[model samples]
Target chain A: MLSQTRYRMLYLIGLGLGDAEDVTCKGLKIIKNAKRVYLEAYTSILTVGKEALEEFYGRSVILADRDMVEQHSDVILEDAEKEDIAFLVVGDPFGATTHSDLVLRAAERNIKYRVVHNASIMNAVGCCGLQLYNFGETVSIVFWTETWRPNSFYDKISQNRKHKLHTLCLLDIKVKEQTIENMMRGRPIYEPPRFMTVSQAASQLLEIVEDQKDSDKESLAYTAETICVGLARVGTDSQVIKVATLKQMTSLDLGRPLHSFIITGHLHPLEVDMLRQFTDDQSILA
Target chain B: MLSQTRYRMLYLIGLGLGDAEDVTCKGLKIIKNAKRVYLEAYTSILTVGKEALEEFYGRSVILADRDMVEQHSDVILEDAEKEDIAFLVVGDPFGATTHSDLVLRAAERNIKYRVVHNASIMNAVGCCGLQLYNFGETVSIVFWTETWRPNSFYDKISQNRKHKLHTLCLLDIKVKEQTIENMMRGRPIYEPPRFMTVSQAASQLLEIVEDQKDSDKESLAYTAETICVGLARVGTDSQVIKVATLKQMTSLDLGRPLHSFIITGHLHPLEVDMLRQFTDDQSILA
Candidate 1:
């Protein structure tokens, strides 16, 4: 029902976590008829690449990297003044705060825009059989550096545990980030993007737990034997989910980047019923 | 590509919070090709109903009430054993744990199923410009009764506030709930479904705070002057968001049901930038 009479529009489309087919029909319709499509590839990624998306959507999508989106967004908006342009974001359009900035810019420019929502891990983690309502604060697990190791996120998890609520830990992804020195020298050199694996996150989490004492003053909030769930590439056919001890999680093969971890607390019986199937207690691998 | 072998399938499709168009293209395609589609009406509702969904989807949808789903689910899955069936869930399929039980049922019946994810209130609250990641445990504000005024959910919000994390209060919806006498009499009489408005929620919240005081004689958790956000009919064209004090919020008119409130703790500069626009500071009524 879209009119042929073109109106200048900027569509922020959510390409769900899976392949192109995962894009909603309405979102795909807008993409198919879009003047241009830019895939915001920084915050997260799809299981498939641009080629697969192009083949499925039948439109060549331009990759809008961090620099393009954060520094040169005017360029992304330039075409919006003339024709309908699409900014396809992985997961929900507002999953990343940056997208909201884009919407603000469009509003300032008097360019009309619309956001088409899709599933984000913030909600999709319910697939792990954890009660979505039981989840407390969601915290990010960032990659640790030798001198820059920070354990603040673990405190958030501790707070959730205090309330007997589940905690969803979003692993970090550093994409197209410039080296500090390189940035200072006005150089365009960038480090290869790094994504935290579930194993790495588990190891770092254990380290933090070792440092923070628990209520007993002898143990920590989470230990090696604590039950945890590691999810990799959710929303894909090859999606992996494992319920194991924190120690076992370090050895599990989740198969890809874009991983998430869950530190569970008290669970309802129904939850226990659904989650027991994935628990390491029932597996020889433990 | 789906194989055209005409296999019996149970598709747990997510009809996004909006109308029929909110159903993903993938979901719509399955609905079009399926032999039956049942809309689960108890958990939540879309902006449009069966008639509008039928008009937009070009297919008739059977209304699956709570009784049919909880007691007589076999009736829903009966057709699935012979042909493709669609069980349309509002928002994401796994948003409610009850739907997970449905998956368990489908598995028990040896029925194959797939969950097509869509935007749920869990993630759609991002529209209010609050960083979804920064939100802590979500709480539900239920209708208070003379003898059954349990305020346990308030404690959860208090815990989240202790961590300086935002709390998303999911206003309660009572659908087809029967009175104790009617249920005991085996009568079909039921109380009309009730959705707690933001105003009602704020007033109750303030009363609880007045009753629960901290060790130092200070009011626990939130006060009447505490800032809060009220969102009504989210994901619809008429979605309204207002920011005001808890006392100020108790009188604001946000129109119909399906309202959610945010008990904000700490505000990031960017979140403040976006939310300030909705703040009552600029209101002439204030």
Candidate 2:
């Protein structure tokens, strides 16, 4: 074994947006040496399961579910202070706000940490031909409830459109969430929340636009006729990108859970040409 | 060897946002197997050099510089009818307009194509604590000339701020560009162009804002006191992210090239906390 400072150290590896081998060269080195490897599960999930990652890395991984992180952070953080620990996250470490919070907590405890970065969905969404710099604020579209429907995203889209910038919509993901009743009862009951699909999000957005029209808002949000791009399984083998109007997208079955949408504002000529190749109907450009 | 199909074929592989290892699992497979590998060189550069990639992948990469792609498309498109040709781009293949043009050209020639996605700077900028969905149009700030200074980006920034959306400012990179004399002479003479630094960009932007303030456009595009995040070597091991006011950033030395700036608009409580950790002076937040 190497000396205290000469041995291995804590490694925060970013499992690329898709699968197990998506791990980079530096990430692979740390994983191979880690005494205890934990996959942070709440932020995101790989297309392949934990078994697939185990086969590729040749190591057993502890599933650090939300409960583990929230309740037992000391377990992961403590070991890192003295010995080598690897806490893995799907996508880059800073991709999610939760991971940033975790890093801050570790820093407060004077734990030395190294972040091994990987491809994230934020930059990966550029596969649609939109200029990364031309993109405006990104927003998440969540499943609206009868009581909890919110239209604030409408203002954001409107603002992006006003400047002719692209808006990347990260669909909502719900993992290991509990219902209000289950929390109050203090039972271990949990409900599986739905991941927002592009189709569902578009339908909701159209309704909100119509509502804005009815309420006489000064600016129009977006119509069913507005051109949008729907992307599914972005970094995987079965990835799909389709460009169409909101009405046209309503009928698109992109397949599977992780889906995202892009509502174009004013498009550069190059952007229009790029989006046209992905669509079945070119009339969206018209 | 895999037999060549009767149909024309084009394989697009994303180089991720930074280095060669940033390639997706699917992308690496295609690049290794393809008959010809062409690197699209104009749009962006990986943080690491091409030689570093050549050493890692164990393959000779042909540079498809702008002149080669624009003036010699036949070289890339010719073998597509008989062999699988891979065109590698920094970031997702479709992240830039030039690659989109190549894809459209392939489609016109009835070529079958597959795009392997990787991360782009678009989504990677989220590491700075800005919400992906809350960003407004991303703009490119170019190196200004005394005779031809343009401030069109000012309008876009102003509009985004009014709506409380973050603006990602992609600094300009000018590689392998020619001078007016060289173009007129029809010779291969070239003039080195400038890559805009974050500090230089901030100073120019402040100048534009001052100019705009004097004009009828009284609305502030961005002020010297406005908070901004300067990011350098984003995806590399030495990546640095700093949050400071424009005035402060103008004087600080970030070191190295390929820098970007983010002019912040609105801040969520969580974003405020995250960015505060990277802020130059805590007193600025107060």
Candidate 3:
């Protein structure tokens, strides 16, 4: 019972949102000692590059794309039979929700694994002074096209409003997403990855509201005058957060990829006090 | 422009869910260099005592009770004008949601502060194998009394169920709470701290249904047969998780103060597969 089992172990470590310093001390120690380290590159993007992480940890990190992680994961789990292999993720190891798949596969194979946890945007959004508990279901806003545009996220936002709960909209990120025609031809042709900014997200949201307007009494969900908060590069020193009306969000520039938008619900006095700090016009609340 | 403002700094550090090792490297570095460190003691509980943390950090930590933190915080924020001071929190600094108050105060007073993030139970609940994104609003289940049993959380769970989302129920903890009569006497007659357990939570939930029953099938939203997962001491080496029917949970014992439970709505195949590992007989599905 003492030492009989194989030492094959996998460490899925979370490098918190901003930079390399965001990685937890326990995670960093393991990264320095592990035989191999893999940085998950598809779900979310870290503001810094792999070189930055390598310089900080004093080790070379292999980048694991979606294909490698979803398809060829056997290679990553193989050598773990004798040593620890660390798979680093940009936020909490469970941040992207899909990370659970990796944990499942590892568990299916009986490979010992431990998750090193860190801050994810889901929790860090509290920086905006919104109570995390007050938020309802979180929805992702995806990029739209001529014929494939979808507005299902609007319904979730509406339902959250009915419950008087805030809604956190996670903007879609397309990394290594293949074009439809290229996929049909079995070619590797890929479109440059696109990140949906808060401005674009607001426009799409408004478009849906416009489409659904029969007499335009504001849909009882959200309107051009409803309050929305836009955040970009959260957790970074240069992070930006601003509050504005839905119409104003279309023209505001918070900057950068990985933008998040929130539609607020009934406001508590403290929440109002906090949001006042980020509102464009101080007279709105005064 | 840079040298004009005072250099007073306050660091609100997150000591992750478990014991001392859960503190992030950035947080630990700040703790080591700070002149005084305060551990917030009321909002949540750490599995370990202050001495354990002090021993691990090679420094002394002052326990900041609710009164000290909420009313007498000026004492903790005092020395920061001339030296660095760290305020440590039991989960992510924002996990309690109320920490934002301190941040607002610091900002209002022109006291520069930074938050060193770590894992909170909200994200760490992903270990139960539910897709974290599918989770709806988190609700707190407080201890009930003869005339004070609140049914608000029931409605929230119902709303989440209607949306086909999982609900993370954060059981309440009573730390340093005093009796109303004793409080009026101007004496701090502290009641021994109480932590709500999964069994007690389940019973109180069922009682609510029984009271509302005219000819009830499952008016409480969750029935005796509803699927429930209970977790104790999450993120620690001795963490325990078990799955059972709501009826079965009333008798099951998962030890320790920090416990969490999930009331599932629609279950994905992956979720069912993952939860199967924790079921006692493995015949719940078969």
Candidate 4:
């Protein structure tokens, strides 16, 4: 009890990439001692629910959505000056830049902070049999709209492919977002959360290929037949991995949200063997 | 006890990046039930020693060096066909390619295996405030000999810089490596383990710059004044991070092994601010 009361600091604990049991013993101990525990929920999602975490830790957890985290972060850190405040995040705390912003804000406020590291998607993608060392710049594929289609990620992917390096594409996740019309009227209403599926990302990527072909601009980095690896619910028991061409992936369903897509470059013999477990197309390896 | 006896599979558990307490509750539970626990020791080093991990988990741990992992892996897996065998790895299990080879070997032998993910340097380097998404292909800087100096890593760095993407340079670790003379005599003797320090890596990199300058073959990707980040023993309490120029890093000494170097590319305003806390040279940020 004395150890708990003496230290009044901000703890940014990573929940790893799985269920409640995935929390490190060090992180779990701190969670038990913290006066307040806030689970940041906008950037990522865990496989388990809040009740599962609460049941495992035997502590109450407050879900901090985007508005609460982005706009009212001060409230999250208000009591850190006098008591331990646990700020929990899915995967590693620094996996997303938003958590770093929170850490910097705490530093600006003169509050001490501690980060408990855990497995993040950046490293867990290695489970797909691709070497992490060969991965180049990672890109994010956002949900495309009628007028707002972004393809800068395609250029980055091309750059990586030119160097024979893999590219990790993080799918879009829209949470607590509002429609343009609702926002214009100053409404706080929100749309249902949307987690991009692997098929959607593959389709969007194929569209980019078509767009480039129609315009006949610079030569494309990858074609429709280029190899791709799609990962779903990584780090859980129900995790799924599929390997095929980009065209084949457009119809492949991985059965969950929180999906990640990898557009591979050259594969080593060992990597090719590892990927063989997930795909039936043997000729692609040839 | 029945639950332990029911599962006779192989478990590849990640010890995370810190002390023994960093093991996930799920992993810890598996370790507790394991009939035999082997800690893979060659690819990486942990902050604490074998006794610390053994005491924490209440299990006797066997150190599995490169010889044991590579030459005698069948011996390590002999009992996995009938009992729970916990193979522990520092950082994430898949951080190193060697672990993947072991998994592949197990699959070939018809031994079922499960991977427990944890934080690895690939993602944990984000603690230094460089966004993970901005990183390009990761390269390794091995110790250079007079006649065997390899500069291919330089070309990769140049490629990454062309895209204004940061490069993560993984410093080399030589464990139980035999000297050329000893190997010629068929001796089993070993050299002292050498872990590359930031200053040593910086000096080697400077030599590359000098070689390129003298030959005038290809322009250097980075100069002595380019901003670099040096991280040592990340995910630990006494972890050290320094942000400075490659020239300054040549003289900088952040103690201990397991060092990682970063050659930064373009920096955003927030990234500049995040790097400010580690360096005193404000002019570089300008």
Candidate 5:
């Protein structure tokens, strides 16, 4: 049972993508009652602006940038021993591994904490008609360098395909990233990072498959003709889910900064039925 | 742009697992404005009692059972064409594949629809520290019968293992189920069915693994000592997540009707850290 004591702190609140109104009722109650509310902004972005959240909740939200939470967590933990403080996150609190560290810290400090859950993109991708349980080991595809191109994600995708399970590829988002020059000069120089788009990811994946074939690592590897799904702005009013071949998706224009790709392995009848509605051409499924 | 006139016909609203207040702000507005509201009671259950929802919403909710939805969808769809009808589903409207069919039907009839999303157990399972994208092919484990035991789930688990991705097993729910006698006699007879418990599922999985090993089909297989996570009443206030060996979890009582399991495959450093907090023995990872 949760104590009614006002000194208790709640950490890691998942604000479902979209708007402040997306917060669960339990999350809202915690935010309203907390002595201070901090939004962790570096990890992910909410579709709606923070001011919109302030107007809806009628409370000023403190921004908890990466530096404050990562480098200076003591500030948030100081009054948490006596006064209630809440750390907000987009999506489910534990969706990212970093927040789990905060929970462990709270446990070590003997400060009781509660997690307010919300919708996450993890399962939201099921809206495209894939079974949530059938997705195998999700891998992230990061931007490749001219000299340092990694192919571990290719191996992971190959493994998923062997089992005939869906592969959910989380596009990389680089925020507050430091450049090599900044590290060398001991200066806090930051470079504007990029979020990988679905089209770019699909093209890269095709290239990796072709590379494997050329190296004789695997025969009959996936190609641009492979069926895939491109999703943009998931969990929002303007959310779009489209089904296309890898070749088709490579050129398909899906507006937005955050995008994800689904490389399907096997399809159950029900899943195929669901995907059919989202596709413009049925030949892609073939 | 969504047409205002379309808003009058069909509204697909998500009722979060807890109570009526768990519905998003947009959902509440649609529900209040709806001339009639139907609660989908088949796919999932809410933690809060129905009475609590009625008290909070100040409206009586018409329950829509499986029969009503499958056999009498016209009742809901017919009214939607003439009045503002709201269909309330636990979790996001698209969480279940069946709901998408309903929306497609409404679309075929030229009934404009809007879906308001909410947190569902699909992503809620990420609270266990497993990457949402890392999960492969979610499968349902049904209660076994003496002569009709099925071990097809083993294939899916093996597939996940091959890819080193976590597998989320959604235990079978037997709500409003019929008995074998009713089918043979062509009578309206029903028997109270059972919800699969974590212990039962683990026991059956062990049996399958042993059987497969005996047949030499798979020399190596998961056993009672396999690491697993048992979750009960996910998305509820009393939700419990516990990590233990399959042998230990089989005898551990979770104190709930709805239970799910996560069979760990490969663990990342961060995943190991997160699981440490919930494991029965912290040194298991070592």
Candidate 6:
């Protein structure tokens, strides 16, 4: 049972996307009694802040940034062996590979761990009216700089389209990262967090399409007029879903970070009807 | 806001993948005060029975079978126009297309609806340590009869394997279904519910593999020794994850219903290490 009193176990709880109240009842009960509660802050973000979670949970939450989690997770494990430690994740605990690594670390130290599952973008993308079963492999679109521009995601999208399957694009997030120069100089300064918006991702994808068209027109997967979906602040009250063309997506602003995009391949009539509800221009559906 | 007292709303809540406590705090609050509560049956099953949920939420729950949800949904929508109603699903509300149809129905009747999302097998399959992003299109395996033996899922598995992407196979659940004779006779008799076990799925898949080998050796996707991951009772205290070959899977029995299988395509070193922990025979990893 989860309520075993004698055994002090580590609970990797999932705080479902949205406000503080999104946490499961079982997770909340564990958080209230845990000796130390740490929130993983890099991979994703909730609509609410740490203070809001503290207010609802009646416990102070420690923010475990990328450094603390990747470099000094031993400190987190040390306490978990003696006392019940709550390591909270914004979505499902296993959504990120790093959390799986934490499980491995805890296993190495003979520390027992339990996972509390909750909703994440991997499944919640169905909110846009697309069937989750029809989606192919999910890809990530990172922020590209002048010196480095990677287009590997384009090939995956093209493959998915070839199979008449949809693709979910997880936009990148840069949190608590250091500048290359600062990292080289051993400086502790960190850059402000930046989230890749849908417009930014659409712009990048358009460039890939342009390059592909010039090289091999027959191999192009999507064009400027292809339908694309943009969702922002999913699982929250301000959630927005917009259906438009790739060019239209480049001009569309979803109003906030934590956005995702979907490139469509085949749409059923029901899916088209559902997508029509979120589209501002019915001409796109036509 | 969800707490708006003046507006009567219909809430489609997700009762995660496990027991009663898996429901989000936001969902529990709505269930506590809802005038009428319905639990969807047939698509999935929870580890705990309906009595456990009623005892925890302090409300009597009505079991809404497929007929009630698909045909008599207008009755469910009728009351939501004047009172708060809660329709609880075994997983996330949007996991099934039926729920999406309900949303469209609610829209047609001018009844406001809100969805409280939670974990479903689509995302909770990550418990097996296969990265969620690496999964391709999900496929369903139905109970095959002597006359109707379908093998179309093999092609999809082959496609995913070609892309080096994993495939999540959802086992079929036959609940409250009538026999052909009973349906033809207009009798109300029903067959006992049957949940497809991992062993049954593996046996069926092995048959498909044998057929493929005989007809076209080049088109075969997986052999008998292909790695398959089986998970039973996920998100519960007795959750089980097992990694074995397709032949080995036919001999392994994971207790209880709602079993899922994964066909591995490409495994990262970390994924291999994580999977090794679940595998009984180390030689599989080797």
Task: Give the winner by lDDT.
Answer: 6
C-alpha lDDT of candidate 5 relative to the true structure: 0.76
Ten consecutive residues with minimal summed lDDT in candidate 3 chain A?
Answer: A1-10
Comparing candidate 2 with candidate 6, which one achieves the higher lDDT?
6
TM-score of 1: 0.90
Please give, for residues B21-50, the per-residue lDDT of candidate 2 as tens digits.
Answer: 667555666677778888887778877787
Query: Per-residue CA lDDT of candidate 3, range A158-232, in tens?
Result: 989888889999999999989889999999988898889999999999887777678557555788777889999
lDDT of candidate 4 over B46-128, digit per residue (tens):
88999999999997999998888878889789878898899999999887544877888888898888888999888999988
Q: For model 1, report DockQ.
A: 0.53
Q: When only chain A is evaluated, what TM-score does every model earn?
A: 0.91, 0.92, 0.94, 0.95, 0.92, 0.96
Docking class of 2: acceptable
Per-model fnat list: 0.56, 0.47, 0.54, 0.78, 0.53, 0.71
Model 3 Cα lDDT, one tens digit per residue, B1-286? 1122246589888898888878876678789888999999987877899999999899999999988888987888886767888999988887754586777787787778877778898888877787787888899999998888786888889888878898999998999988999999989689999999999988877776667677557445767777888988877766888888877888989988788888888888988888887889566645
B1-286: candidate 1 lDDT, tens digit per residue: 3554356779888877776777776778889988888999987877677999999889899999988998888988886777889999988988643487777787788887766778788888887778987888888888899889988887777777777788988888888899999999999998988889999999999888766555343436877777788998877656789988888999998998688899888878677766765776754123
Model 5 over residues B113-183: C-alpha lDDT tens digits? Answer: 76667777667777787767667777788888888887788778877776676778878877777777888
Best to worst by DockQ, what's the order?
Answer: 6, 4, 1, 3, 5, 2
- lDDT tens digits, residues A89-155, model 5? 8877766334866776777787877666666777677778787666777778888889987768777
Q: Which candidate is the best by DockQ?
A: 6
The per-candidate count of clashes, in order, stands at 1, 17, 2, 0, 10, 0
RMSD of each: 3.4, 3.6, 2.9, 2.5, 2.9, 1.6
Clashing pairs in 6: none
- For candidate 6, lDDT tens digit of each residue in B145-223? 9999887898899999888899999998998899999999999999999999999999999998886676666568988
Off by over 4 Å in 6: A4-6, A96-98, A215-218, B4-7, B96-98, B215-218
